[model samples]
Target: MSRLLRILFLTLLLTFTACSKDDDSEDGGTPIAGNRLSTGDSARDFLSDENFDELVIEVVYVEGYRPTDAALNNLVQFIEERCHKSAGVELNVRSFPSPNIAEFNIQQVDSIEKVMRSQYNLGDKMALYVSFLDGKFEDDSDDSVVLGAAYRNTSFVIFEETLHRFSDGINEPDRFLLESTVFRHEFAHLLGLVNLGTEMQTDHLDTENGSHCNVESCLMNYRVESGINIPGMTSEENIPELDSQCLADLRANGGK
Candidate 1:
């Protein structure tokens, strides 16, 4: 072939290959609008094997705010027990430099996720993003501190710095216990607990407290995320579990 024709052919081949590669890994290319949906919007997908058979939890924490290994393991176990992910659940955890913000709102948290998160829903594998920040949530108040929040369908944030202040101290819960509880609770929101997305099997929604369950001992209880509730709730060796009503809702929603 002529030199000019050969050069043009090579360029065309390279361009076509790049475009094909991008189309094949569309989910990993960039954040999709579907991923930023409201919390609970993807509950059925997470709970059932209908849409996604595998679960990938992308855990990103700020420097000095990595979650305890025990807590992360607990989170995986919790997910396996509740979600029907026949392909299994996995966690990709890593840390980044602190944003240096004293407190974060949902918007700020979302922005961080956009920049730092690597996993996204791809084919039969669903992705969840969990951020452990060094600061507190902006909505935290002196009387009612926030521990974590599930802001998007597959995203949540844990105020790890605030959790450290409340745990592993005199008369306080163990750090792993507190972290595990918050992790499960926030993840339950993604599963649509307490009428968030999955329909409630019973009227156990704590209407006075947003999408939380009314059962005081339930993991989805509104107080579970409050600093005041930690000491009292963690008196037992085991962290809180979803109440029967909540479990019923999960079963109805295609969960195991």
Candidate 2:
């Protein structure tokens, strides 16, 4: 190649490499595409401080469907206990007018996230988005109802309207207990529980249910996130916790 052409090519290559590094560093070495990845894809980022030294939970809810303070507190406590964010964890809560939808599918929930979510991985902080909606999940049936779902690496939705319907009724669980249980259960999915991003230390995945623990008493159990099971699962004063097998998996995957 000519000398002039070769020099130009080298300069262009250097510029491109510098820009790429800047982009990667801005996102804590995660690509922009990583933000849209599937659930549990960022489990290590959430559990360990290798990439992110701080965590921010951005919670948005419909005006009339805000989660109880107790539930939100429980969620913060749950994360602090497991994840190793040395710079500390923070919660930012806000509310929006109801979207006026009675039922929501995963796609609709994702669309709402795209419009309403304001936080993303930046610098040394990893951000998570949680939404409380005034609707039931589209897949809910007469026999079973979903209380919450972790649908993306950093996004989840809680059917707060549905939770209220099921809780504090005849033979039902307390609203705070039920809300806290669903919140922790969905967050656990983001942390890669029950064979979901973090590898399991032992075989505990429920074969019939998708990405849930087989242990009935564990917070990752399938029934823990179901409205139909809340009465029975919340019969005790305390909420369910991660079983030994699930705890082992978390510890093995950079959790405390």
The superposed Cα distance between candidate 1 and the true structure at residue 110, in angstroms, equals 0.5
* Tens-digit lDDT track of model 2 for 1-256: 1111100000000012222334433335545445666788888899999999899999999998889898899889999999999999999999999888998877788778867887788889999999999998776666556777787788788888878877787656788887887788888888887677899988998888767889987888765544333335454357888899998999999999
Against the reference, the lDDT scores of all candidates come to 0.77, 0.76
Task: Please report how far candidate 1 places residue 151 from its true position, in Å.
Answer: 0.4
TM-score of 2: 0.84
Predicted candidate 1 versus true structure: per-residue lDDT over 21-42, tens digit per residue? 3333345355365566778889
lDDT of 1 at 25: 38
Query: In candidate 2, where is summed lDDT lowest over 10 consecutive residues?
Result: 5-14
Steric overlap count per candidate? 0, 0
Error of 2 at 57 (Å): 0.6
Model 1 worst lDDT window (10 residues) = 5-14
